[model samples]
Target: MDSFSGSSRGGFAPRGGRGARGRGGRAPFLTKTRETNPDLEKHPLGCLIKEFGSPDLGLNPVDLAKISDCQYVASYNWLNDEVPTIVIPGKPPQWTPLQEPQRLKEDSGQYFRDPNAAMYPDYPMAPVVNAVLETDSEFDAARTDVFACGSTLGNLLRFARGIDKAFRFNVVVIGDTVFFMRKDNDPREVIKDVRGFGHTFPEAYTTWEHSVKGSETHQRIIRYKFGGFSCLVRFESDGYIPDSSAVTNTTPANTAVGQGDLFQAFQGATISQQPTINKLGSLKIKQGGSPVPQKSIFDLKTRSGKYKKDIDMSDILPQLWINQIPNFIVAYHDGRGLFEDIRVRDVSDDVQAWVTDNSDGIRRFATLLDKIVDIARSNSDKLLEVYCPGKEHLEVREQYGDGAHALPADLRDGLDGSKDGDGGDISDGDEYYDSDEYGFDNRSDDSSEELDYTACSAHDCGYCGKCTY
Candidate 1:
């Protein structure tokens, strides 16, 4: 949470021999100075903090404190030049030389030199969210309440509450379904990316913002589930929820296929017919009819006697369904806006439909990809009809229509001109909701430009003079 200082600005000169130790025997290098950059402070993020100040969002400090005390077998502290240490609580920590310390040192040295590379003490994603919820408060009431409600971020809170919480980014739950929110590293980068969603979702350009406000929002959302890929690790609390299907018990145990065979058989099954792992041979159940199949399934090898790589049925089955939840949510909610519809039943229905139709392509096609391509081909026209206008911009354009282009000369500035009402900026502050940084920024592009139309046909001449006028 420290504002990075300039290279020339005075900072704690690295403690000459050993780093300074503080309370609980932690490093002082983690200490942040009050130095603030005028330019950075002027940035939207800084301005918001100044205007809003920090408000307590009802999260607990103890939740975040638990992270620092969580047992980590191996600790990699870059602030200290000491070799990676083996951390055993109560015993003096022991350091081990890296296999190629020179390479590590060189790479890390250059990374630390980068101006944008701010140092963050190693910690799981959960505590960061908890800390932010408890401290930083700037988002709108609707957005802030999502986290304050607790249930919205319950799964994530669960992950962070545990010791050694596994880190997963962009994972969110809408209703009964949990989804991995897809996003580019940068929206500007997406504009330049030839294979980006910009073409499919032309309005996606405004999705990323480049300002400090955008940066802070991006950081908070990632901690609160926005962009970046997620890992579906096993937590003792809950298990993966895939579509329900009957497990055939008629198959003979002697003739049953091994885990390797089962995976191979179902690996290619359409997303709809994901392997309904009803049996695991000797690994099926525990003493009192409890299920513990991870170790056995992970140990299974391929038919050629090679260990199955990342093709484990255990993770793949759940992932097959887990990964698709977002798509269902997007298709159902995106016309309105991503995560805009937080209602559980609406979101859950979309998920159930997705699982029924896409998971086991038998309901539709052989695979989810095929279903998507087919749907796109079928709805290609409808998709083109929709434009990616910001919520405010779209309203303005709709009100004015084509005449919007030739609205009164004074009203030409789009929103600024109309006296009655123009779609106001999405958020407070001049930082337009940049699409480049994180989740949907409330603001829209200020510049007046014709909305880009995505077309699937060469026969119609709507805007461009290709086929017919």
Candidate 2:
């Protein structure tokens, strides 16, 4: 056995590919940018660096989403990254955490979590919150029950594509995560760790805060709160510095915590003719967390009987109105120059062709919504109430139907008794009363008497009075 130091010593057969035995041995991973992250000129004039060079991962139906998330995070960190500086001695770090936990929790809508890294406040990336659930399998729903992995993404992106152009993001999901950092490892110092993936995000971004400074107005008060907040969702597939510890994620503190944020982000974006970016940052604590409860898909499939996969397409609301912040910003950027616009890169002709051939917002959104309604409706609470806007897009209506069949059929197809007999369509109530009396106008004789069905659909006579329209 031989022991080697840097210059003259050598022993433990340095393991690696053929290149490792060469005079220059490549480091496993770089602690410094120059150590391992080679400068690949991906952008013009060396403007951009290949922050992540991992071989492309498959964006199968289940993993299609993180593609853009990873790309965005990688691009975001590429800006203003001069060689990092190592700090010694010590000084305090500063951050502007939200006063309210709810608001703070919401700031990062979608995010990545790296579990194998060192844990400390001085870590140079967003500390992974330890309440989210990591995805496991596509074959099971619990694998994605609000888990935000493939199924949710499959359904979400499929539908998002259907969202009008004004609502589509220049959403570039890359395949990695990164964190802003300085070389230091002391907890008493400041932590500017905004971790995520890909390279589309600028070194900074603008974040909106609630303000009421002007007269009688809740106008958007904008300032460069931090150039980074304006970046897109950060991912972890790209290399992160020194890696961060696992995050502790949580499900809705309460089920009542409806997907309102999700829905509103989508709906509002569409209405405003904008792109919705509800950047959700979820992190699951690998070793510590409340046991994630799971609904038995077996019971649900059983209850559905032969209709297990027989989806009631009508259960999907015709238009979910997924208004999100990104949608609005994109829209605003186009029309009013409010948000920065991402340069559309040229995709391969094949990818372009695929996008052109299969791109359909209306159909995509409709199909995915149907799937979500079904998956979410499988709640053991057979009486769960799902709702949507009615005819006017103003009034909310409540219905007593199967949740899984939320949109099994169109609500508009069947006519109620009221509008039919008025020279419109046949009325069930009218036919019952028309037997010996003027249907619907008989007034109140015996209020307690049960209406007889003898004069049902088939018993109608030429006496048009008892007959339906």
Candidate 3:
């Protein structure tokens, strides 16, 4: 990857006459609809335990090493349609340097919506599985320990460090891999209305400089080893910088399908004219994008310059560490909307420093993940819920009611250990909640103390509710 170039002044370059087009025009805001998963609310909490204690700073820190460099396993972009249309291997928006200060519109419409479910309602993890199978024929799902999205892992990290308020997610042991599915009150619930330029600034600053024009969101999957567990992490990428030296235009080798077969499969593939729902409930795969190198990919943010506050690298490092994003761009705007102080930084070193500094928290996070996986595997049903009812402790209980499966039946059958019998009952030493009601309010009586959910973004903050942006 090329080193960062010094800052320069210029007007936003027009993207016309580009070889390929992208989802063009201002990005569309999410709207209210019935696309939310109904089963999310039907999940009744089962068992609760408080075995895992808080991070013990007195203990020596453990090493957290990246066994494998972050690789782009798969990507897709959300298109504006009555029914969601996602183009696989979707191109991320390109960073277009700004030459002149520009006034952008404040964000409007729904503040939060789970694009993963909205795009692939039948099986949200279908894209990740498909991409892995396509790119690597020898991919062993049974050998992998954890498959999760950045948000799910981020929530766990916050819980391990005792920094986040409260959250809940589903844990299903499919095959040998334990899948962590993020659960919100409503999959498409509007947390609140947008208030800042966090959305609009990106629309004005970045260009989807490829055939995937008009894409609303871009999601990517990566694989790595952490804490003795192989993890396949899916995350929403903000965009990528075009760097020929760091990025490859060819698809990964798929030995099972024949060398270059996946590339041939995607050749000339365009966005579907209509929603292409396959048997697995995934959208039709398309072949127009190059696999962006992790080095060229970046995370972006926008903040107010009125206070002249410096963006805290610490607050953002945890997120970048989870995604392994190498580049970071933070644009500062005066309260109104004129962005002038735009900083494009290479945060690879900063992230490493954060890992060393937060080793205790990371060790605890790894242990928490191992405990959850054990609890899920111990249950005969192989379905469990991880609920954190505040900064206190986390509960791992059997999933009850009409809880949904993580993936479709056929895909589950393909996994190596999917049919494994229940290991045994969870240990008797585990604790349980005696309360009849499983409900807990996450809000505070003082409105001022309430978190601004709108400030959270799937890519930058994973909707952790801690970001001031």
Candidate 4:
């Protein structure tokens, strides 16, 4: 078999249609800068060079992306391209390079994994602590949980926050598990590995457990010290069931732990939901059922069970804010004076930049809060007696019924806003909401707090009152 190697050895007369034509019926020349990827240019160039047996191969460069499969073959190496040149009989040699095809650059936002990648990061991007979950498992360590994917860090935070909206929580990337431990592996040494989070494991939760192969397995939940007024949720393998060996398959870990279903079999007791939190920080029944609805923030479906695949929560928050706040400007700056300003229509850019610059801070903040919450809960079991504010309490006595926190009238035409008698006229894509008709007492209540709603529609906000607005 002839080696596919393109050689400096053979030469053949150029055939018609082999090279693209120029405006004046000549062989078009290619410059190095003609292609963004040098490899794209080199592969075709090498093929032409080998086909015609010349180092000085000239043809249309822009036609690289347009080259048919039969005309081009990719190189395995950087430039030692191997290609077989076939000569067609009776075709006259003629050459003129083709014009460069116009191509648009891909949006850089596709690379960001931050949930708020569509919004502003709480802090700047420089202080990001990449808390990677490291394990010594015989199989790949990352397969233990989705959070191990690194890309799902933001999703972890969002899920944790949504689980309990009453208080902020930090996510402790629970490192190393039983699967990663050898019989000779010291549990204490494994516990020490929690230092990767820049904190020492708490003496109390030095041990944890897991459920694998339909059996309850013991493991360690490395609790590190976290401070501040929030809760700590361990992102561990308590509910993670390995579908297969990570060594054999490099699939991401899928958790059996549903959102908001915490403490099924972990060290920490489940934070019980209280009907009404008293001033003394105790749960006191407030008679009728709690007003706040319970639902998952990560659920991509509507209340009607319609899933909007294109709508990502990260992308929705900014749009919701834009709808309410007029004259909003989304801006991006990279310290290099490359300032890109976008309006509401192109607001996605602003969110992407914010996420890129601040994902580290958000993750760290969640971790720190988790540590603090963990320590507090350990020291005082009383802290566990948390008062669920019975959904988010609106101190404001609005005549508009409790639906004051409902979706915008226009967006809620046939939804909650509609049921509340505030349905607006949806004509020509314009909606009008009447405060008087809808029961909203626009008259500012000196006592009322801000409105709270996940969508500008309806669903049970699982969080006590962590509405987006």
Per-model clash counts, in order, read: 16, 93, 14, 22
TM-scores, in order shown? 0.17, 0.17, 0.72, 0.17
Residues 364-396, candidate 3: write the lDDT tens digits. Answer: 787777677777777736567788765676677
Which candidate number would show the highest TM-score if scored against the true structure? 3
| TM-score of candidate 4 relative to the true fold | 0.17
Q: Which stretches of candidate 1 lie over 4 Å from their true place?
A: 1-121, 130-132, 135-204, 209-350, 354-469
Residue-wise C-alpha lDDT for candidate 1, range 1-469, written one tens digit per residue:
1111100000101111111110000000101212111121221111110010012112222222111111111101112212111110011111111111010000000101100012121212222222222222331222311121111122122222221111111222222122221111211110110110111111111111111110100111211211111212211100111211211111112222344333322221111111011111111000010121221111000100011111112211222122121111010112211211111111223334433433222211112112222332343222111111111110000111111111122222221222224333222221112222223223322211212111101111111111100
The clash tally of candidate 2 reads 93
Please report, in order, the local distance difference test score of every candidate based on alpha carbons: 0.17, 0.16, 0.54, 0.17
- Supply the TM-score for candidate 1: 0.17
* Residue 392 lDDT in candidate 1: 16
Global CA lDDT computed for model 3: 0.54
Q: Kindly list the per-residue Cα lDDT of model 2 for residues 36-140, writing each as its tens digit.
A: 111113211111111111111122242221112111101111100011111110010101111112210101111111111112222222221111101111112
